[model samples]
Target chain A: MDSLTSPVKSAHPEGTAYGTVLDADVALRFSTLDAEYEAIRERAALLDLSGERIIEITGDAASAFAQRVLARDVEYLTAERCMTSLVLAEDGTAVDQVVVWGRETGLLLESSVGGGTRLLEHLKANADAGVEITDRTAEFALFGLEGPYAWGVVGRLIDGELAALPFESVVDTQWDGVDIVFARTGVTGEYGYKVLVPAESAEQLWTKAMEQAVPAGQEAVELAMLEVRQPVMRHEAGEGVDVLEMGAGWLVDITKEEFIGRDAVMAAFEAAAERRTVGFSGGDTVPAAGTPVTVDGEQIGEVVHAVHSIGLGSALGLLRLPPDLAAAGLKLTVGDTEVTTLTSPYVTPKSWSTPII
Target chain B: MTLEDLRAAAALRQQTCAQIKKMIVSRLDLPIEPAWITDDQPLFGRGLELDSLDVLELYVAIEAEFGVALYDSDMSVFGSVSRLADHVNPALAPSA
Candidate 1:
């Protein structure tokens, strides 16, 4: 699979920095990380989510096949609803965290940014007799609006009523006479909305949206996602890291009778977890993955991933530690800098207090 | 800090988180086991999808179970089970 470049790449600012994440070429920064982060946190930011592949599953047995593959129960998911689910391998490791959107015909799975190819292969390998898996990436372009005041953008650019739709709600709506699939969803802990538009209209819509909201690139989006503890699979998932160790078990529904990885998941749940992922923040310098986390000169854990958190004003990342030592409020050392094991939502999201009205 | 001492400190926070999880599963009458709920998963909106009525139930349950009144606290206290533990037992809260 070739790396995906955004459909609206030409519309991006000239100085925008670009980088590769997995199988996609993404805009790392539209402006400065500081400006983009501020827009996502304080106001509204537009996102060209073309990095995420939109694959549709259709045919007579699509529902059953989706149930067999997805870690969540989506057997009765209607066209008006959407949900986030982890697509797991048979060994209980994550393939990707995807947004399962309910379409009238069948269903669409939105792969995590730069995580499409792997998810597509997994879906094909498990294809049922009557299921039809189609890659719709070239047919449509996905755009997102997020932040405390993103609702205002929805009212001016689309519909006011959509601004307050229940989270994960899906609607077939229109923009300037162009049909699109609109959803009330977001990764950053803010008011978020996404529109799936025809590829030809993507640039026009992107230009208009830029007029109302600052265009945030992948770097800033991932940072806000980290602050809220949302799983960024590329940074977090690695060899031998099971869902239990990832602490992303919430994305799976173990109660369901069957799924591709149910047996392994149950085994993981039944067996005691050796290592668990937990959030941590401290140190001016961001530590690299595999950096030893020590206490009193004794190695206890290792950093899974870390970055300079604009919200924490320090290095913010996760640590894979012994289950007993994974709880919050522990004073530990990562390299030369002392760090503290912290609770989730390392930073309080302003959207929590700011109502759509 | 020694591993033994760290274990002891972690045990305290884990116990609080466990208690809160039990209270939530019991109060919400959820279909899954209390142990199934991870310490870091969100309790409302997206993860657990608990509605406003459920929030009211949890608010009362917390006051009764932990003797902590979170009614005046921001919604972020419910960000995750570990987060709620920090609020109910301030000692477990990591300093900003």
Candidate 2:
């Protein structure tokens, strides 16, 4: 099958450039990266995230099947509610971190770009009778609205009470009279919402959302991820680190009687984690992943990911280090430049006049 | 404020700091003990060295636990445990 395309691609003008993500061609930028970053930070930015895959599981055994494959409990995810979950290997290592949306018919699983294929295979291998898995990647398109004004922009386009919607909650809402699944989620830490519309209606939804939001591309989204400390699939994927070491232990439900990788995850938890993921700043240079980190001339760890943070105005990096050397204020050398370990979230969202419920 | 009032406020601030420290250690599963986190230690750099995602998780956890709302403008409050306590104490106190 051909890789799916974003409906808004045709709308981008002459300066727009495209890139590949998860086998799909996506708009990398419409203008300068700084402008796109500002749009998401100061005002609002719309992102075409259709490159991410959506898989549907339908059957009487859908819930049970999810319970078996996912690390988190699915019982709380009633219709219109979503939860971030991990698909773990039998050894308890994370295969992917996905957002599971509860639907009345069954469940919709949204994976990071290029992540659905593996997850689909895992489900098929483990599924029992009465469960049916369908790849709906091309059938729907996802658009995200992010920034301080994201809620306001979405509120103006839709007739519902958008502000009252809690984070991670999904609702069936209308945009320009087209039915769309609106979820209070985004890669950026700002107040954001994601609109999931049928492929045919995606262009219409995007145009309407764009009226109040500027177009942002992958570069801005990635910068936002780093500033907020959100883990990307590529950065988090690897050996030697389990979910606990990745700072996502809350997603695992050890109370579950049985699930894939339960024993391994339990054992990993029992053993002390040798290395942990950390964020660092105060570096003049952005180090690439696998760059060696040294403390007092002794190798302690390596950089997993790093980027020049527009928000923090410094080079920030995600590093994996020995827990003993991971304390704040600990200085380490990355290729001759000294970087100090800092707590994550180089930036925070602006205060809201009304509390987010 | 009067001396008695000052005493009460200081005591309240200390309690709030302790509570926030406990929340951070438990929610983030930090290897260090809560008592080891000094009130003046920076919560981000040169102190706990929490990553950005950890801050996001802590934000959610704090809102759920203390009924306090943190936003981008409030980022400075995270400079230290005492600063966070100073910011969140009013939110946790009984509404006048």
Candidate 3:
């Protein structure tokens, strides 16, 4: 197969930086990160997320196959409904976080960036009696419209009632003479939607969406993710931690009979999680990743993700700390700076009365 | 139920609504004042725009604060502050 390219890559002008997503080169930014970040928070911003992978699984046993590989229950999912789940290793460590969409034909699994290959292999390894898996990443281009005005832009383009759309639901519709899939999903914690269109029509869709939205890049998306306390896959997963410790136990359905790492997860829960992922603010200096967190000069945890948030106007950091030390208002030291622990999601949406996107 | 009991229950329901509103604002770190959150305002989607994750956090907070065990399937209780008060008020009543 030929190397993949994002349909909207050519639209980004000078000063645009490129980065590898999955195996494709994608535009990281068109303008300054600050400008893009502002667009996504206050107004509408369009992002080309085509670098994320989409895989299709079909056949009689597709749902059963998915149920085994993912941590969430898949038996109840119906057409146009999406469930966010974690693909786990045998030990219950997260391999990737994926959004699985139930379609009429079968199931569509959308992987987080850099997660496609491993997730595909995991699915194939656990394939049931009669299931077929295909890589559909190259066939489709994904774009996201986020921020307070996201729905308005999508409403203007689509004929349907955007207000009726529920969160985590998908709608198959036509836009500008092209077929598209609109999923009411977002990473920014604002009103948001994800648009999936054919690679051939992606440029046209991008052009139309851009008319109403300021073009944003990955860095801005990351800022939004942090403000909302959405965990980064690479930073949240790995040694010394499990999904339950990351405060994502809600994603795991204990009622489900089985899944890839169900046993390990249950055992971890039984053992009781010793540490948890929490957010912190009010630090004069932003701490680097892996910076030690201490209480009274006693080391307790390390910073997993840190950023200077323009939205909050403070340096924010996600830390893995013991439950005793993670309470809101608890003061801890990061390097020489004293920081106060706050709950996850430093930013909250101001209003839900209006259709956000 | 007796008229006196009914009156007491109504007062408890009102108190529950006030408490729930206060807990939501403080626990979720919402910027809105607790007094400003009307009883009938929707808590999810258009009214307050709280997402599923927010629902989970709110559930944990309510359970901790009020000792009311809300099931995941009982999301209708979250339709509005008034509805949540109705669901929780009876539970708060002292056992006969």
Evaluated on CA atoms against the true complex, candidate 3 attains a DockQ of 0.04
**Candidate 1 lDDT over residue span A1-357, tens digit each:** 889999999999899999999999999999999999999999999999999999999999999999999999998899999999999999999999999999999999999999999999999999999999999999999999999999999999999998999989999999988999999999998999999999999999999999999999999999999999999999998988899899888999888899998899899989988999999999899999999999889888999999999988999999999999998888899999999888888888899999878
Show where candidate 3 strays beyond 4 Å: A1-5, A21-24, A351-357, B1-96
CA displacement after TM-score superposition, residue A133 of candidate 3 (Å)? 1.2
Tens-digit lDDT track of model 3 for A57-142: 99998888888888888888888788777888888888788888889998899887666777778878778888999999878989
How would the docking of model 1 be graded? high
Candidate scoring better on TM-score of 1 and 2: 1
Candidate 2 error regions (>4 Å): A351-357, B1-96
Model 2 Cα lDDT, one tens digit per residue, A273-340: 68767677866678988999875676778988888888888888777876544433345688678886
TM-scores for chain B, listed for all candidates: 0.93, 0.83, 0.79
Which lDDT tens digits does candidate 1 get at residues B1-96?
788999999999999998998998899888888878888898887788888898899999999998889877589989999999988987876652
Which residue runs of candidate 1 sit more than 4 Å off their true CA positions?
none
TM-score of chain A of 1: 0.99
lDDT of 2 by residue, B1-96 (tens): 332433354456557777998999999998655755645454653246576788899889889888888866455678666557656766322231
